[model samples]
Target: MPATRPPTPLRTPRRRPKKSRSRRPRPPRPPPPPPSESPAVDPENCPVATDAEGGVDNAILLPDDPWTLNASSLTLKDASYKGIVEVRTASGATKRVLKYVISGGTDIGDLHQTVQDKRSGATHHVQAAKGSLSTITDGDTVMYTESISGNLLGLIPITFDPEHPPPLDIPLIYFTKVTVKQAGQFGGTLHVPGLRQYITT
Candidate 1:
């Protein structure tokens, strides 16, 4: 019987394949974008509007710096904050006020307030001997005006916290305008972004 090739030699079955030992590769993800930068605070580029009362009206920022006061970038007059006053009434209530001077920074400067000649429409000058601020006022408050040494103009820092919400000491600043009224018309306006904006971050 044709040597039936020696009885088929016994052979081991191939080992069972490991159940899909490998997995499908994953998809790649997209990279993140760069952070956005805020534009510099400028009347032209940023939000600058006048209030019904006029004077740098209010250079306010919203959504961002919802509490921001002053135009940190206000360089129009180049005045510096001078001092603060805390007012306590007979009712055990208190208030914080800020003072700004037209001149007398580092060395000595000529601080003048400018107002317009209502009838003549000519620019008038009122020297600012000094400046001061009363932090909380539901509306604009022009206080303690005095003549500038030798000028006829009346001077004082006109300030307001429209909302007037407060800690009193650190009230929510709204807008500030330093005025040098020659008589009726406005002479010039100064920037008062409040203490927070004035300070370096």
Candidate 2:
């Protein structure tokens, strides 16, 4: 205990210059307000412009007269890229023109659907079957469908594209009951197919 004189070397505590909290330079965060042009939906004006088409997430089922899908069967399993569309028929005088080169993807779970009737030129085909397949019947999603003839009226109300950016649901339906192989008939051409999809999440 007589060596107390050696304790004088412990006075090296002079590091008090760390109070740098004057962070007033953080105002550069305002660049995020420039990405909204306002029309993520409801601006097609409606001449029969159903919805769900924000850039690359399309799903416009345009049903002004024939849109009955109470869920009999429609499963898509996630790889994205669905198909079924029929535009050009609202006073434009029936012009269902859809062409696809495919080039890749689309025989995974089955449902490559297509339908065309460009003023009776006639063209139809159907698909659905790789796992599940049934495709609606009767009623239950609210119930409303009765126009196999005359003055039709159904579907026509889907508008879902608020900028369409979510967690990879990318048109991933994954499965449907079964039966849709036209010509000789299996599903009878669900209004002549018009559901072109492209999901790659």
Candidate 3:
């Protein structure tokens, strides 16, 4: 036999080593862009207009403050304010009246408000020697006319649960010719985003 040589020697197969999966480090992300600035609350930006009631109206915006009435922002001249008023009659029933115009005043830092009765055609006005408009409450209540001291005019309930709407019959005051006062002491610095004027039909 061509020499079936010795029986083939047993050969052991070599095992290959497994490669480890090493993750590569990711590149760092870039910084975000800065926030955009809001438009200035200037009358030049907000032009004057006339409302349906034949009253001239003007307004400006406070980009920061939505509530707290900024006393220094308003420059009311021969202007008036109209809003909804809730009153209790002698019959012990609540009633909401409209066209409750509070107007008439010659001075800027003076307390003067005039109201006219529709039915009786009579007018009533009040003026305080040493006082300024404190605030415009959410209820459309103008405080500081009679009393000079009080919390900053709260435009709305400061704290409320958004999930559950608060039981508030918040009223709105439509002002006429509300111009921005000079920017100095408590002027342009005090920002109130609330509506300076609203033209109602």
Per-residue lDDT of candidate 3, residues 38-71 (tens digit): 8779865554354432232212211221112223
Task: Provide the overall lDDT of each model, using Cα atoms, as 2-decimal numbers.
Answer: 0.29, 0.30, 0.31
Best by TM-score: 1
Model 3 weakest 10-residue run by lDDT: 180-189
Give a tens-digit lDDT track for model 2, residues 84-150.
3334322332222211112112222334444455556554544444343333322211111121111
Better of 2 and 3 by TM-score: 2
Of 1 and 2, the candidate ahead on TM-score is 1
Whole-structure CA lDDT of model 3: 0.31
* Predicted structure 1: clash tally: 6
As a TM-score, model 1 comes out at 0.21
Q: What's the C-alpha lDDT at position 148 in model 2?
A: 12
Regions of candidate 1 where Cα sits further than 4 Å from its true position:
1-10, 19-25, 43-201
Model 2 segments beyond 4 Å from truth? 1-64, 77-86, 93-132, 135-172, 175-201
CA shift of 194, model 1, Å: 46
Candidate 3 clashes between residue pairs 3 or more apart in a chain or in different chains: 65-193
RMSD in Å for model 3: 22.1
Please give the RMSD to the true structure for each candidate, in Å.
19.9, 21.9, 22.1
